[model samples]
Target: MNKAMICFLLLLSSPVIAQKQKTVDSKINHVTVFLSRAQIEREVRTQVEAGKTDLIITGLTSQLDQQSIQVAGKGNFIILGITHQQNYLSELNTPRSLRILKDSVEFFQKQLLIEQSQKEILNKEEQMLLSNQKIGGTNQNLTVAELKGMADFYRTRLGEIVIARMKHDDKIKKINERLTKVQQQIQTQNELYTRNTSEIVVSISADAPATVQLDVNYIVANAGWQPLYDLRALNTKAPVQLNYKANVYQSTGEEWKNVKLKLSTANPNQGGLKPELYAWYLDFDQPIYRGLQGKASGVRIKSAAPAMAMDKEEDAMEPPAETTADFVSTVQTSLNTVFDIALPYTVSSSNKPTLVDIRKQELKSDYLYSVAPKLDADAFLMARIVGWEELSLLPGEANVFFEGTFVTKTFIDPNNIKDTLSISLGRDKRIVVKREKLKDFSSRKAIGSKQSDSYAYAISVRNAKTEAIKIIVEDQVPVSQNTQIEVTATELNNANYTQETGKLIWEMTVQPNETRKVVYKFDVKYPKGKIIPAL
Candidate 1:
């Protein structure tokens, strides 16, 4: 043999030459999950065949995004680059990312429904390891005897291998520890982030099918008034009843269901006069809660009519002789006239009631009366005049009277009179009038002046009423850098003022409608050319 032929023969004879190491190029197959109808359909079909009742498309896409593939009849999901042991440990240890990993694992286990023996083997091994930990023994102390017992209990061939691999892999151990810490940090950070981000956004697709929008129609009904006669006086009392109905419908022209309804009454005088009457009482007894609509009812009882004498008492007592001068004077004053009449009944609703006085008052049975009541009928009543029409006393409506020598007075029913004639006449005549005069006087002043560095303003308020009253003073100023507004009211010892960007508020309770004043001063500074208006 020649030298070249000998070399070739030697190479062929060598084990290294005959059985050479093959270079295998490892490539990570990147999974790209394309959101399409076909993939979803396939997954749905597969899940249906496997007996899953609830299938979430988003969950399936999430599994694919994490590079996991689910195969039927497999005990666990297959992660291309991860070994079975590595996957298990990763699932046990990873933080927030564990949800995806766990779902993937569960998906595989359910699909495959691995043999009972294999599952029991894994469970036995896990229990043995847990028992060892309880006894404070390391994984290395898991002897062959323990392993054999676990294997025998579960009757699985892979029990020993699983235990050995779990104990000896440093990467797996470190991965678990790192995963646990990372998960804790992530959980804490996620909770903080969610707390900080405190709002949820829901997106509705513009391309989705269109539907009709819901509409609401509200109508006020049963708005009428009835007379509430005064039992003591021959005057008509009118009580008004108002009803409202709200009809709700879907944009598809269908009626709505289980809609909540509410009624709110606003008194226009709440912010101006008669704040005590600004209360709104809800009438829930007349609620229409079923079907696609609801209705509500409210009633306001007007003044009642005064009481009247039954039968012809005058005919029984013998009619007084007809006097020409006396009868003419009574008829002349019978027409509607503004009389400074003192109320006979007590005002129960409020602490302060209208007080007026009239001396030597007379009334007759056939005379007419035009009396103006000052209590707020309604805050939003737009009518310039609101009261019941004049009517003769009858069985339903009666009028009241204070009989004096040479005078016969008729009183309207339902009027909130403070006292009867005896009590009204006995009391000091000037007390009620003085109290009303003090209650009516209220004044406030605002001072606006320009400054070199900024604009400033001062507010002064006075309450001249005898009774204590609360006054709210608000000042609005230009918002600028280093703006300072100070409100001063020495009389308002308990008052406090709050400052916002361009507004200041001061609340004070003046004594007995007494003249309590407040002054507010504020300063604003900006560029010279920029002139901020004083608000």
Candidate 2:
């Protein structure tokens, strides 16, 4: 062939090539999950020439919130434009562990086949032994020794066959156990690998031939965190140990494996629009006309009548202390606070909550035993914590533990404006309380056109515990809403009284085995024709 012919053949023999854009797969390296939303962050590292390239990143969960998608590039690349698309055609790639599980399943299947073949051989041998129990017809005339030998042979063979069959059955059982485990692993992996993925097509313009690292961030729904707490106090003098934690749940279809996780208290799902008050409008009620059954009779109305005498006794109707010392280490920003977990975690897409420890703090508090005899006969143990606002705690359920024992659960609301946070730990069974009416000081009489009723009550408290304790005794006096009726606290017995809420507080220290008494008197005067619902 001539040189021109040879050159043409060489060009023709060369492989046909087409221009294609650079594509790379980026993984979720970090996640900042909020109370109601999660922000996924990924980084792509690749070398790009001095030209334009389209980087197609796949393997993102389909539950991504499209509007929150953001893309940025580092190094010598400029991010031109970005777009998101659902890629149902993307293949679900199994992880290394899943691949290993597949191998394990194949191995177990092979073992099962071998075990079944052995079992079939054993069955055939057993059948042959059972069939050979009868000898030829000529052997019937044999001697006693010969017949005994034949019987012995039959017995030995049958026993051996039974033992072999049992051994085969045991092997089969063990194989089945392994097979069951392998099948379960396969099923779990299959479920995890069955989800479709999303793609982020990022248009990039490279400044030069260099490695460009692209950071992709997006928000996904159905992933969030909530606060949890454990409060434990050993004694009244010791500080309380508070452990703050977060329970995170996600079902975003992509497992976050060994990723840096952060929990935020900000809720993006909350209404962002400022609330506007509407005009309050009221109107008079409109009457409705209805026929009574088939008759057009008017509805009868009942009228209230004055009581002639004392009515019979009616049936009884059945009815955060803040620590400022970093309960959880938080990174406060302009909009939200974040808790960056120190340890990496793998939060699967199973929607099961995974608890992560935020921080622990020993908070100083005052312990008080309080009794509200008017409402409940039991005395409760409470802890008043001051300067709790420094902890930056969000409202959450707290599990209270006293003296190494789990007492009860109480909610801690940080929005409360009280200077001191009062937490009711649990009921104090060591303090006995009783409230009874003082019959000698109680009287009911009528003067002219008005009726007056006076009542006195005594509250007795005893400290049965061996140690001294701080206690607060509480009671209430009624208030009159009608102008014609008058109500007064005739004798408060030096108790701190608040007129706004009608609550009387008696704070005192009780010694061991000490008994204390509180007395209060109240009187109500109303018109003779009017009735007071409660006295």
Cα RMSD of predicted structure 2? 15.8
Q: Which ten residues in a row have the lowest lDDT in candidate 2?
A: 298-307
Per-residue lDDT tens digits of candidate 2, residues 1-535?
7999999999999997642477697877888887886889898998878778878888887888777787777786778888888989874566677789889878878888887888788789878888777665854577788889999988887788778878878988998898899888778667757778888888877667878888788888889988888988888888777788888888776778888777777777763445545455555785444322332222111112222221123455632233222233466665567776545678876636887777776787889988898889999988887777776788899999988888888888888747887877788788999999999999989989999999999999999999998999989998777888888999998999998788999999989999999899998998898877776
lDDT of each: 0.27, 0.79
What is the alpha-carbon lDDT of model 2 when measured against the actual structure? 0.79
Write candidate 1's Cα lDDT for 1-535 as tens digits.
8999999998989876221111111111111111110011111211121111222211111111111222122222221221111121111112334345445545544433433345455667777665554322466577688877765755454466466545445444554565566556545434322211111111111222222111111111111112222112222122221111111111111111121111111211122222232334456687443333223322211111223222222466767543111111111122221111112211111112212111111222221111111221111111111222222111122222222211122333324432222111011111111101111222233344423332222233334445443334444434444444333222322334333444445555556434433333333323344444543
- Residue pairs with backbone overlap in model 2: 322-388
Q: After superposition, which runs of candidate 1 have C-alpha atoms over 4 Å from their true positions?
A: 1-451, 454-456, 464-466, 481-500, 533-535
Number of the top TM-score candidate = 2
- Name the lDDT of candidate 1: 0.27
